[model samples]
Target chain A: MSGEQTAAIESDIEAAIREDHPALITYITAGDPSLEDTKEYVEALDCGGSDLIELGLPFSEPIAEGPTIQAAINRALDAGTTPARFFELVDELETDAPLLVMTYYNMILQYGSEPDVRPFVERAADAGLSGIIVPDLPAEEADPLRDACDEHGLDLVFIVAPTTAGERLDRIMSQVSGFAYVQARLGTTGARADVSNATHDSLTRLSAYDVPKAVGFGVSEGDHAAEIIEAGADGVIVGSALVDLIAEHGTGDAPAADALESKARELKRGARRGGEQRNGHEQGREEAPEPEQP
Target chain B: MSETESNPPAEDEPNRERTFGDYGGQYVPEALMPALQELEDAYQRYVLDNEDGFMDEFRERMRDFGGRPTPLQRADRLSKRYDREIYLKREDLVHGGAHKLNNALGQVLLAKYMGKERIIAETGAGQHGTATAMAATHLDMPCEIYMGRTDVNRQRPNVYRMRMNGAEVNPVDAGSGTLKEAINETMRDWATTVERTHYVIGSIVGPHPFPRLVRDFQSVISAEARDQIQEQAGRLPDSVVACAGGGSNTMGTFHEFVPDSSVDLYAVEAGGSSLEIDQDEGLAPNSATLSTGTDGVLHGAMTKLLQTTDGQIVESHSVSAGLDYAGVGPELSHLVDTGRVTPASVDDDAALNAFHRLSNLEGIIPALESSHALGFLEEAHEELGDLVVVNVSGRGDKDLETVLEETENRDLDAAPDVEVFDT
Candidate 1:
């Protein structure tokens, strides 16, 4: 876990996908149903199919979400999830998976950019996480925040929206190491059927940039995952669908937890087919109508 | 019948998410999830078993506590000018001084029955804030009010009254620092502490439960207005006019009446200047949602919103702070969309003039927001000399400071009679 180099990060992700296993990104709330669960989930995801475990820090207001997602957050918060707990969870989960943490910007602002955030990124590097994903903070807004993730030799992963301007994409591609998260819609994350045409246009437009772009939000099951990969995306991110699965299964004791873990692993098995075509859409299609102020 | 005795919900459980035809659901943040679920279960049970007797107590409270059947006062000066009889529902006479009390009293009592801890609410002009606090005080429950900093600066009297009633008033200083901002701030709070807090939203907006709950509490308005108007005039009024913010008051009074098309139900919006004749988006961006709002989702529900090509929530402004919301309630949106209701708006000056005119001529300080209803008196009058009822949703005492001779003068002074509006 210690003495991890930056080059070691990219190759690790490349190596994990080459295997028959779907790279599991562990998703635990920073200070959730309990931070103890954060530690538990990270360890579980690492032990299971999770290749890149993502630590999520909750905010009083996560603007980019719908009611269902919001309710899950509430239950987690009621259990007392927090920033310090997030660090502790990562500190304990010394796994081989590259720890990729995700959260809204305000949480970082509340915790601060320098000593507080930098050390956490360094800890992730130590704990074997490859990067950090701040979905709301794009590349332009990344500089001040990016420095901390970089200071620890951790890849600061930025997200590109369906509406990200071309110039912003180029700028983000140059600075954004690790893998980039391409949001599926103009608005916040939620589950929906059918990948919108706008998503296709974004991938084609961003193809010139040579970064590993993973299409996330609404990509569920192996079919959808394979379809996104076939659409030319480097990877597919399964969030709401997976979150829904975890919420359903992962709620009780060890037996119940193991039962949930099997289902989660089963989900990743389907995630591998994401490299093929899904539905009928070919590769890229032009899409418009992006929601304002994501 | 003895209170809470024998009477039971129509079905086995309370109608948790149903509100008449077009109201009710829980579209809120995750934190408030458990609370909404719990309350929905409780409200369904209580209302069904006690609804009949509850009305009796409601009437007693309205009569003994809230000044019953609040005068069907005739505004002769206004009526005379219109060549028709104009009647004011005089909701302003209610205790806490506005129609807001009708819904506040109903919900606060519901909260008490459910055994909730705190009453959380959001307000712009402080009318609903003050009214909710009054009800909470009577029930001896802890209450908290969220008001935008801008509204506190303007509606000082109402703000002070809310504080005096032992309600904690938290000033919101975010985005525009007004009603919407207060709503945003309250939402953040509700999402964080849903377990112990009953978010008593002031209007018929937000997701599901709010629109429905607020409407049920306010349905008493139309129930009373229907019976009262018949008793007073020997027949229904030709038109029922009320100002719309989230449109709860209007819907409450209009719903029971909407089925009566002969009763021309009209809800007026405060056109800050004019419902944007051209598209320049901003706070004062010309608004006319019912007049021009599109079908979209906002706050949490799919309804009507004043947005752009890209569904961005637009900032709306009006001389009446209460009527300055960017979106209308879903029921109203459905009403307008279905042509079940006719929508109207009066620019800042017209509403201001109506406010002062009602104050000086009738010796009644009508809420500036309600003045938008008064602003339509002449137009509403044109159709008939038949009975016309305008819901005086609140007292203008909170607005007297601003709508004086110098009223929204700048907009009114330079403006020509709105051309879009043809006589």
Candidate 2:
């Protein structure tokens, strides 16, 4: 069962990319408002055409998160979220989108007092999680987590920043599995108004890797998702924008779930539009007459 | 200046190991990796190799501007009171009124050499912020400090000092509005500005290169104390004591003497109100990581942390704002685990008493953080051999208001009568 779940992440990503639309990955802090509300939100994302869903297991100190996610994490923690509670949320989640747990390293390292990662990874796999994303654990310190994930048949995903290059880039690319999270900008996770120019460069850098490249950070709207797909990303990860809606509307309300689904659908449509445009350009070039030999 | 001017070129080698027996690592986001690498390269070149005489310039500036070679004065009154030889390494004499300037000056100088135009740091109690602001101003770099709003309100003088030294102080209001939140905010800032900025970490904590880098810069405390003690006392002391917050002064005071098996090192932590944690509140009413903490990651390093069984970091408390931290330096954790250093703790009442005791007996006011070590001296002086050296990490001017108020509220044996001056 764990093996199938493990393969589901890569296959689901591949399936999304193979279609006319790029994959859409949406993130939200689990247990926010409440775990029951979280399950409903996950369903909303899946119904809205999300290919992958990331459930944040909120840590006490989330150094990689900006103001929006930080506020969301605080809310989740206040709702009594713990590792055990997070796993229960995974067990109860009903969704077609492949699930990934995103958190800080200490949550995985301190799951049990034996100072090993196996306990957390094995439990995550058993709970039906397809992969794990730890923002603070770089490739240099990823060996232990990677080994644990491999033993548990879970994908160990890594985030590649805009500044990543040369030997460091090689190190990260080698360690990454399922999909490489390409940070669109050089900062913590949050929403921004403009799509960064560095998105194209980061995607071009990761093009050599066989793994799918999903661009994230500052991707707040449908146009941002479209721009990322046109820039050669295999997917777009949206978090704070959806979280803003959740914050605006209280949990268990129909309007809150509807708002999340609406945003996800808009973003997915934009992604498909961008993919169609790119495919058209490629086909046009292929059908164009070759240059005459001089 | 020309004492053996002929020196060999530094060996070109990669940076040293990132961990102290599995206690330290670069547990940070991917965006900060390149900056760490760049800083590592600069650390090797300028700090380790003294490329273009960087260390030489650092030493000269420290001597002229920052006042290095702080005296290791024998505390005659303290020795007589304790019935043992007690010596004080007066790091309190350094510029910016604490040992914080040692690492701040070195990192700020290294940043200039690395061609960085901006400097940033996080501080609790505003000690590190003041030091970094002074260093940046001395080196003519634009400086900014992230301090908790709680600390800014509590330690107003230090905030003013930092601002007067020409630094932008950004108040962080996240979480408990304390040191931990301040550090997180600084890391966020550095993530965005890593290309043109350098973050001057306050202590022997953080990821690879930072702990080692700060230790190397701060080891001057022990380097000077080791020679001064031998020169004054005719031999190495039996025990060396220093207060451990994030363990900068502790590591600095003990690093040079760690090789001497006969020299016992004691890291004194803050016991705050109690040792027992309020589990429901997720609060540890102490900052005694060396004595009571378990292995966990915080502030980019895998170190000993005052965290709950479920892995959430609990809020830590101490009378001394500088010592109120949930996590400690990884190297100190390694040392305590290996049994090379003994871990001890002193409660708030004892620390406050010692604050007044030192002022009355030695005619020198001691920082509350350093008073924890002095407090331990009152508790375990006989156990520590006949000769002991205590690191006075800073002066107590900043803690005057806190100490006076605390003393007024509590009945302390050493505290002078304040009722006479009630008017």
Q: What is the interface RMSD of each candidate, in Å?
A: 15.1, 0.8
All candidates: CA RMSD (Å): 19.3, 4.2
When summed lDDT is taken over every stretch of 10 residues in candidate 2 chain A, the lowest stretch is: A1-10
Write candidate 2's Cα lDDT for B161-207 as tens digits: 99999999999999999999999999999998899999999999999
Residue B220 shift from truth in candidate 1, angstroms: 2.1
Q: What interface root-mean-square deviation (Å) does model 1 yield?
A: 15.1
Docking class of 2: medium
Give Cα distance to truth, residue A216, candidate 2, Å. 0.3
Q: What is the TM-score of chain B in candidate 1?
A: 0.87
In candidate 2, what are the lDDT values of residues A149-234, reduced to their tens digit? 87877778899998999999987776667778999998888989989989988888877776678899999889888888877887
DockQ of 1: 0.03
At residue B366, candidate 1 shows an lDDT of 84
After best superposition, candidate 2 residue A228: deviation in angstroms?
1.0
* Candidates' C-alpha lDDT: 0.65, 0.89
DockQ of each: 0.03, 0.77
